[model samples]
Target: MKLKIKNKGDLIRLRNIIAYKVFKNSTKINKFVGYRIPRRKCDNYLVKSLIDITQIDASLIVDEVNYYGKMTMENRFDLLGSGWVRYRCDIKDDFRGQYEYRGIPWNVDIKTGYRWAADYLDENDCIHSPEGVDIKNVWELGRMNYLVPFSLHVLSETDRELQMAALIHYRNVIEDFTKNNPVGIGVNWVLPMEASIRISNILISYDVLKQTDDKDILDTEFTILIGQLVYSHIKFIWNNLEKNIFGGKNGNHYYSDIVGLLVATGYLQNKNVFTKKVYNYAREEFFKETKEQFYSEGGHFEGSTGYFKLVAEMAVFGTAMLIRNGEVIPGFVMERLYNNKNLAVSLRKTNHSYYSFGDCDSGRFVKVVPHGRFLSNSEAESKYLNLDGYTKIYGKAEKYFLEDDSSMDSLIRYTDGLIANTKNDTPSLEAVMVYQLAGKRLNYQKKYTNGNMGAEQNDKKVQISLNLEQSVLEKYPIKKSTELIDFKTQNKLLDFTLFSKMGFCVIRSDKASLLFRFGTNERSGHGHNDTLHYEYEVDGISHQKDPGTFTYTGYPEKRNAYRSAKAHNVPYYGQEQREFQGIFGYRTADNREIVEFTKSAIAVRYRNMYFEHIRRIVIRDNKVLVEDYGKRDFDIHRKMQLRKSPAYGVIDRNIET
Candidate 1:
């Protein structure tokens, strides 16, 4: 027989095949059974005793509904008593409605979008629909089942009846569906059964005590029906695990991870019926996939800083829990956690904040949680006492702290020693003596506009010095400047002015001197673009020029231009880029001062004399001296000149400690 080719028919067949494959691949069946003490046996049992003392009916408590309308019920509550224990109760309503039997408000409705799988249902009826299937159709067929019922037998009588009606309505829906169909495939239909059977065994004797009550019959019926549902669900998960792990989907790593999480949660809760062998298999499968997700740097391969933190935290917690339970933790888990912790520590700044390297998620800068707190929920509570309060605390312990360091100690020691020198009456004019004696301060405001070019090359490679006290200072009221006159003329004083602003200082004398600058290049060229260029003091005369100018674009062609050679005081005589526009030179004599202007190589042959150069000279007890070893000739000439203005702002003597 030959099949006829038709468009819609072919599409429908393909769709069906895809749907079948998805269902076959995705099916997981597992039963989670809970244990608790019987109601009558717990008259003074911690959790049950509270219910009795509070006079609340345990049966009327309602089941919670998540935002998606799925029902959720907890078989036990954490009692605030000395020890924690679980107490079992039966559902009075067949559907295990929102309330316990005595009508107490047993459940809370969670309005947020995040919810567990069992939250959706109208009592025992499941609200979730099958893949490729209509929800309405599933509802019509009565395949969905109610979630586990919240037992309110512990709540007060007044609240029990109030909450009972809602519970009954929910139970009726489940009962109706079960009556019509014996088998179903929804989360609600499955989980409650396993929970019920396990809970029933604990309540065996209590059943006889409540036998006379109508509520007892409904509870028993609900319990039995739920047990069947749970059995079926567990069978599904088990069968699927067996099929898939052995030989099923070729690449479903996500599914495998989910299965591991589910198995772990069940094992921790003591809800799963899996034997030791089965449980071991599930755990091994989980760790295998988890190990591969780690990168060599110990970060999650997903490349998200936030995700890495989250995953690493979870992994650490899980491993700790397993260790506490006597399970062997994989070595890779410890390695990954240690690596990530070290990386995070390394990235922290002095302020305790991390540089936002890699794909960082916001809020990562929040205080770190204590290492002990990461072990378990109970341990965390005990150590911190209050989680909220602990999170607000800053800083870490000293031994493993990121802030305390040897590097900081060294910086502190250096700065403290230097600050001491700036304190006493004797000022070390070492920096000022080497660089410049007297020159108009180069105004950076004007020089920077043209270009910052060629500034790097002019930086002095040699050192020079001067005796500062011998120099003379004159105030130019009109120019708003202070000029110093140096008696010594040495090689026309190489233009260390521009380079000195970047921190280099030239200290030169007749014997020997040194040029000292900590960092380099404060300009576009070398990198350090400091405003204070050169410094030199002779006798009482001190000349310090601010940063020099360089063309912003290309090198200056006029080597002799004021902006080029004399401006920065660099000896670049070749046809190369000039540093700045103008050069300011000063000399002082007994009665007059000489100022020289070099417009270009052609502009100034002789120095200009300024007769109004009135200046005071202070002779300190220390004699002014110059030291030069004679790499180049040193010449001292007396030239009278009016002092030019100091380019930079007034010198502030205050030094920070």
Candidate 2:
């Protein structure tokens, strides 16, 4: 059959090609797959409600129109108002709404296939559909369900008129859809219900939908619909929380806390429906979980910095919500919140940077809330409003916390008393070490992890210093003199000797000082790859250089590597994974000790009995000394190699000075 052409020669060729295929495939598919399934009646209550409200007939509405066949007809409309209009029909499915609201006219041209129908499949035949055809196959038909009502502006109308028209159209469409109960088939059809409610509220706030004689009908209906959606979302979260917490599901309690906070905020803002009983129940559950999960030291039990921040933010928000609502805040909840804040603050260095351990976002350090915010529930919002005052308060508080020498003394004495009074029933030297290390020291700077000792100086050196006598080593059984001391201005030279009880630390002005740790019968569960790890400064940067601790559950890599022992900086020549090879008993031999003389070099030694490894470092003059002692018969094939990078200087100690 000769195809009739209207607008241009290209239009005729394209329509003929598509029409030919549609005729052929529609026949073949019907023969092979039988007739297409009829559209099922949609059971969507909301859509039905909308349709009833709009009083629109669902069946009579032309959802879509196919233009391929219609374009072959003789009748034409000037969509562009050009006398040379090319299309055969003025209102063909393809051109019907193309030029409406200032949209580009859909014209037939040859390049590749049509963009819209590139991935189009016919539900009738389970095959590709012809390009530029009104989507007829049930599968292709479902794509229309995902169409969202958007604002349209006609070129001739003013901005206000267009906006008002758009608003009326939106209301009409929403009403029609609610009454029609349209069945959405695709994943994209899942409307952003929450976003829609918020938008409707905003529109109401703008007075675009004014109250008139029909105010009760318009405003009351919209309000009830929005309320239903908000309540449904809140109820879903509440049910999930109960299932995760009380039902013993493996959901994270921290996630539960965040959801609770969100719910509380929504309720307080009058956006969600929450009963008094429900709120009380949520609060009770949150308190119970926080007390059980959070550590007294303020560290998150999950050992994740990211998770810690998430939980802390939730707690802060919850606290503010409770205070605003005139509810009583629990003491332990406040205490834990404060403790978490302190831990986060302590993790920061003098350079105002933080360690990226346990999935921490380093960039978040700049946005840290001041200490005063955690002091009282009311102050949570103060940081955002009174930033200058908050900064001053934080500065003053940090100075007092770090500079109070009397407080440090009292803490040390109190820790010593605890150690002395405790029996050896479950002797844990690691606990004592942590407690002693907990006290803040003033005028003494050291790098923790992943930081250089003198970062700002551009020297990028590693140097460190420690007060050996005042440290936790006084409680250990080993004599201080047997320990080796090594010192270096940079990484090059070396000065070495045995150290005294008043342990010394090598401090390179532009580098991190190295303090050696050696002790018997102590284990920190949160110990690093270096059981005898050295914490110091490198080029003015501090890092949690110690390899992190690990557990056997779920993480088989950690368990296989013997909790990262194979990756320790120390030498472990002959020990099997998990095998203890030293003189430590009951307690795991993980110690942090540095031996220093009155004015000479500083020697440090750390040994992990479990890994059968030792790292000995001595610092004197402008030189550094290092010795790796591993088990003599350890299997090199199974053992990990010691990877050392000596950056600054040559390692030589025998040259006579």
- The C-alpha TM-scores of every prediction are 0.25, 0.35
Global Cα lDDT for candidate 1: 0.26
Give each prediction's root-mean-square deviation over alpha carbons: 29.5, 23.6
lDDT, model 2: 0.30
Kindly report which residue stretches of model 1 are placed more than 4 angstroms away from their true locations once superposed. 1-234, 241-274, 296-299, 302-325, 337-657
- Model 1 Cα lDDT, one tens digit per residue, 31-77: 11111223342222211110112222233232221200122122222
Error of 1 at 286 (Å): 2.3
- Name the 10 consecutive residues with the lowest summed lDDT in model 2: 399-408
CA lDDT, candidate 2, residue 215: 24
| lDDT for each residue of candidate 2 in 320-356, tens digit (9 for 90 to 100) | 4454455665666655654454344433433433332
The Cα error of candidate 2 at residue 543, in Å, is: 5.9
lDDT of residue 91 for candidate 1:
33
